[model samples]
Target: MKKIKTPISDEEISELQIGDKILLSGVMYTGRDAALPQLVELIKKGKTPINTNGIAIMHTAVSDAGIAPTTSNKEEIESTIPFLSENGVKIHIGKGMLNDETKKALNKNNSIFVITPPVAALLTNNVLEKECVAFENEGIEALYKLKVENIPGIVAIAHGKSI
Candidate 1:
């Protein structure tokens, strides 16, 4: 089992393994398909609805049925990667493989892509024993899994900003 703090940096975003365990603590928002495109537009227009720096923005559309995770929900065609990187979003959490365009953006943006299964999200939320927004990189995935890492999942947290 491993731990990471949320709202990380471009440097800390790298270095993660497939079967590593993660626990995130920080006020996080869910960005469904409906919201992502608009958010991307905001990034392009020189603005953002929420603070992207060092934050975990998962890509799961929450429905009355709960967070419905889609494999090919948001590709570069729908929302470009530059939008996300330009806005300083440190991480994107979700399942499914990222398109090559998305991968390029992630690498360029210096944002880590921490994956978690849809079912484990709620449970991972429960076992969040600590808060770590600044960052921690315990291991690096030599063979980075293109697909989502199931079971032993990933977590990242925020260290709260001053009021």
Candidate 2:
């Protein structure tokens, strides 16, 4: 396993390969299906509050208790992945297989996908701090900014030259 610190660059992303175990530390954001579409809509309206460039987004609605990876196969999330990548999101942390189109988008956009294990308590402990950033009405599906330390995961997909 490799230990990776956040604010990751394209060069660091290129070094990762599918199936490589990783422990990531630093800042990451959390957003589920509800928040993702909202983000895309905000971007389209030119009102995006956050600059996603080079950021990693974990697929979950975070709470003080913990966070768990959500499945990516849902239509809402699956469709949002491409748009998110196009908008400069570099790392996606979630559980389950991403659709082929999303995978293609990741490769085309030089982005990667990491699969978080299904261990909520462990993941929670890794979260040093969390704060809701947007869509407060969505409750658990709200966007969150998180400071994490040694969060465990594995690369499910890597940014490649070709799909």
Candidate 3:
């Protein structure tokens, strides 16, 4: 498996191909339906709370139950992919296929989509630290910052290619 650390460089992203397994380390962020839209709005208004450049974002919620991949193709989540990629989010972690438009956007922005295993226990063990970074009122659905090590995933989409 390939090993990656964030904020992942464009060079690092360029080398990835669909179906390559990866062990991701360093900081990642979490967001799903409730928090992702708010983040997009924050970016549009030039009020972004965190720098997105070359960072990874997982489509999931953090709770006592642990974290696992959420359906990224959901309307609210999929709709944000392009804008988020435009804003420098290089790696999107989740499961499921995205539309053609989203794939083109990722290629244009030098971003990629990764699919993690659905096992929550496996994911939780990789998380070294976690904190809610925004939209706390959304509770478990809030945007969160995570420090992780060796969180495993496979590259499902990169540079206009999908697996």
Best by TM-score: 3
> Which stretches of model 1 miss by more than 4 angstroms?
17-19, 63-65, 76-78, 120-163
- TM-scores of the models, in the order given: 0.63, 0.94, 0.99
Report the poorest 10 consecutive residues by lDDT, candidate 1: 138-147
TM-score-best of 1 and 2: 2
**Which wins on lDDT, candidate 1 or candidate 3?**
3
Model 2 pairs whose backbones collide: none
Q: What lDDT would candidate 3 get against the real structure?
A: 0.97
lDDT values of the candidates? 0.49, 0.86, 0.97
Per-residue lDDT tens digits for candidate 1, residues 1-163, read 6555565655555555444467555544455445666667765686655677766566554333434334433553225434666577675666665555566665566655556666735533344222222211211101011212222345321111100
lDDT assessment of candidate 2: 0.86
What tens digits encode model 2's per-residue C-alpha lDDT throughout 4-100?
8877878888899988899999989988889988988998899987888888899987776689899977777778889888888888998887767
Quick one: best lDDT, which candidate?
A: 3
Q: What does candidate 3 score on TM?
A: 0.99
Q: Rank the candidates by TM-score, best first.
A: 3, 2, 1
lDDT of 3 by residue, 43-94 (tens): 9999999999999999999998899999999999999999999999999999
